[model samples]
Target: MPTWDNVPKGQMTAAVLTNPGYSADPSDCFTYSTDYPRPTLPSPEWVLCRVHAAGLNRAELRGRTGAAPFIGEFIIFQKEYREEPPKILGEEFVGEVVEAGSASGFTEGEKVTGFLNGGGKAYDGAYAEFSLSHRRRLYRLPATTKLPWNVLAAVPMSMYTAWGALNLAAGLGERRKKDNKPVVVLIHGATSSVGVWGLLVAKDAGATVIATTRNTEKIEKLKAAGADHVVLEDDIDTEVLKIAPDGVDIVVELVGPDHIARCANLCARRGTAVLVGPLNKNWSAGKFEPFYIPPTRNVSFFTMTNSGPGSEDADVDHPTVEALLSDVVHKIETGVYPQEVVVDKTFALRDIGKAHQYCEENRAVGKVVVTVP
Candidate 1:
């Protein structure tokens, strides 16, 4: 329904896939769509940014492969998307604002970073040179001297999801009290991007943190990210129990079905456990009461999803969501949040097939980013 007449002049190169199917590497799914139209402000509150870098998410792979909640059965399909010809598959980006709408609060030349969930939801994506986003979702970035543009691409998606699960789902920030003994938080699968950001956000909230990761090399890095205790994935229960005799106040479970019950059992009475990622192949846990019932604690469970009631766009200026996008950026700017940009690898936009292949291989330690020339 939106028109491109208002879109900027000039052609931009983008990675696109016209057909959909499963492949061993998924590199074959991509085609370099040349002469793409540059994006313009879609609304008065939106701004058009010239994307410098875009990060890949596992959901992109799932969507390409026709997985549920992404592209298969559950996710609704629109006729416009089907008839639109090429499909772009990226959600997060860091760039410079090229044009601002009349009501957009940002300046034209400011650098910004943000997550726009439009690949399968509403708008196109950031794989192209130019992308549009709501002004409230865009956060001003410090000078490239403070943080490079490529590095910030890894922050928006993972950090925002982590912040959302904690603030929106678990209410960790609202419940945190500095005067009292710090709240205890547990992060399962802490080596992943979301898990690592959860650890940092929990620590930034003044909570005592326990993290689980298989990588021995990242133990010290995890500690530096404000984790009070870092233990192996298998040792989570033992190490966490040893530290918090009662149980943890909050649990961010990145590992799925197999570990969900254990994570729930580790929560204290009236505690909260947020299941942000389902890494396990099987999501069904049989019966909830029998397999997952906490022995002593009546804990609450929150499942983080891409589309839901509170799963709206990230508003930096107005943070109804658990820390605003601006809040997390400030944390990184100030010394409260970890400033490390853990990019596993980078690829040119034309070689996006290789980028998706790299992420599908599941060997990358952190985020896989694609650079736009």
Candidate 2:
């Protein structure tokens, strides 16, 4: 590997989750890897970015805790395959462009953040002090934003997924002023990192946001995150009916089939359930057909895979990416969305496995960060 022209040597430190082909138990957390080689730097082939802060997303939990492999043969080889071992995995991140390659706009030490390509599956992700980002896939972190390192990293996977599902795939973001109403957005699993974003976007888009959380304690936090009303998962139906009798115009479902029927019930005519995120680490990651979709109701289900295949797919929708990132940055800057509420906990890179367990327990209010000392 070629040395990054301006970046220093030996600055690498990352929380690495080892993938052992089965469900991870608390005891499995006994060993956590640290300071493993950061992605090496080079010349024309690629440029490496030094990470300042990387947010912990649920997808990272899935990859590390026997959920899925960061880079499986299925993605890289263009063939059928099973899961592979895990390397450093993270879905969303905030970093600085420390080394620019041949073409240049990004300067060394410029603050920036973005999501992992290809859903982060089989993709080497950022969870370290230094990592490589394909210059094409990376972007500026937005000039107006001032998020703490952890919060900046947290935006990509969860929030972008939420934005794409509701607005793009589910056909919600297309609404013009005349069509825009104080519509109701039913957000499932309100305390999930993405769930926090659904609440943020729905409100900013002029919709009334109704969020759901398994733990009652999270309800207050969801409200603080801009949920118009917060309800426990068990009481979803009653809460939505009481608050928005017209029914929900959109449903961001984090909990899957378990809540499918309930999601359909709350939807208004032509409403959609952008149900890509599943809360449990053990389940196959996806957004399946709601247990039922009535012709009369016209409810649609969308997870982000509809875009294309592998890491290269998301780039096809550059405008979508630009809008989502810009919108999020605006909210973050104006305090419409505060990064402080998005972190559940943080651990040093040495405690990588503990971070995995924290995410696997499925009790986090938001992101679980692994920071370097």
Q: What is the TM-score of each predicted model, taking all chains together? A: 0.77, 0.79
lDDT for 132 in candidate 2 is: 67
Error of 1 at 238 (Å): 4.0
**Among all windows of ten consecutive residues in candidate 1, which has the lowest summed lDDT?**
70-79
What's the lDDT for candidate 1? 0.68
Q: By lDDT, who's the top model here?
A: 1
lDDT of 2: 0.63
Q: How far off is model 1, as Cα RMSD? A: 4.8
Question: Which residue segments of model 2 deviate by more than 4 Å?
Answer: 1-11, 18-35, 41-45, 69-82, 103-107, 117-123, 143-145, 175-181, 281-291, 299-323
lDDT, each prediction: 0.68, 0.63
The residue pairs that clash in candidate 1, if any, are none
Q: Per-residue lDDT tens digits of candidate 1, residues 215-234?
A: 68878877766679998877
Candidate maximizing TM-score:
2
